[model samples]
Target: MPPGSPSHPALTPRRSPLLTLVAALVIVEALILVGAAVYLLHGLLVEDAAAPIAAIAMVVMALIFAVGVGFCGWGLLHRATWARSPVVVWQLLELAAGIPAFSGGSPWVGVVLVVPAVVVLVGLFVPSVSAQVSR
Candidate 1:
């Protein structure tokens, strides 16, 4: 709203929900990594290939999450509008993945994963945040 500052012509978009979603997902994944490490210890071990594969997967996932969160947050804060869907899909997929495991495992897993998952999904659907994505 500054005078003579060359307005964007379009209204500034808001994507904080998406950015927040990414942060929550990152936290959930950190917990997952800890849980997996616990399982890998104390004779709850998986097979040979499984250990290496899990390690690689964790490393890659951490990198992916870092980049995705950075990009989504930057886009959201700057009103870039185009960063919404990828973040949405990413979080949804992680949520979906936690479901079956939750049913088979302890209750806390689902509780941890679902809360933020729902928040992020629902938050993105709201009028203000939804408007950013629609663009």
Candidate 2:
């Protein structure tokens, strides 16, 4: 088929409001991860007591999540069906981490993580959003 054939899906899918919100949330999460990575890297450079290995590990962790989740969000924005599973898995992991943080005396951090996870979870599962992405 030709690149612009009528039967072919457009490179950018029509986005529902919920899907837009989901994409925004995912992007925000990616930005947060990047910010953390930068902070860790800065600490690694400046803080003498900070173990270099631990700092590097933290930066790597942040980069992994930023790239992985960010790619999933980008794919979701393009309406790729494959994006949904990884997103759901990421949200589940976020929820799992949030729950422990919530009970571990850092209620604020838990709320910050959990609220978006819950919102994304609900938004993704909405019938209209799901249908649009699946198509």
Q: Could you tell me how far off, in angstroms, the CA of residue 8 lies in candidate 1 after the best superposition?
A: 7.3
Compared with the true structure, what per-residue lDDT tens digits does model 1 show for residues 19-82?
A: 5564455445546655555554433245455476666666566565656655665565555567
lDDT of each: 0.60, 0.87
Candidate No. with top TM-score: 2
Worst 10 residues of 2 by lDDT: 5-14
Instruction: Put down candidate 2 lDDT per residue, 1-135, tens digits, no spaces.
Output: 676876565754567989989988988888888998998898888877457887898899999989999998898787789989899998999899898997799999899889999999999999978987785
Considering summed lDDT, which 10 consecutive residues are worst modelled in model 1?
A: 41-50
What candidate 2 gets wrong by more than 4 Å, as runs, is 1-13
- Estimated TM-score per prediction? 0.61, 0.85
Give the CA lDDT, 0 to 100, for residue 116 in model 2: 96
Residue pairs of candidate 1 with colliding backbone atoms: none
Error of 1 at 34 (Å): 11
The number of the candidate with the highest lDDT is: 2
lDDT of 2: 0.87
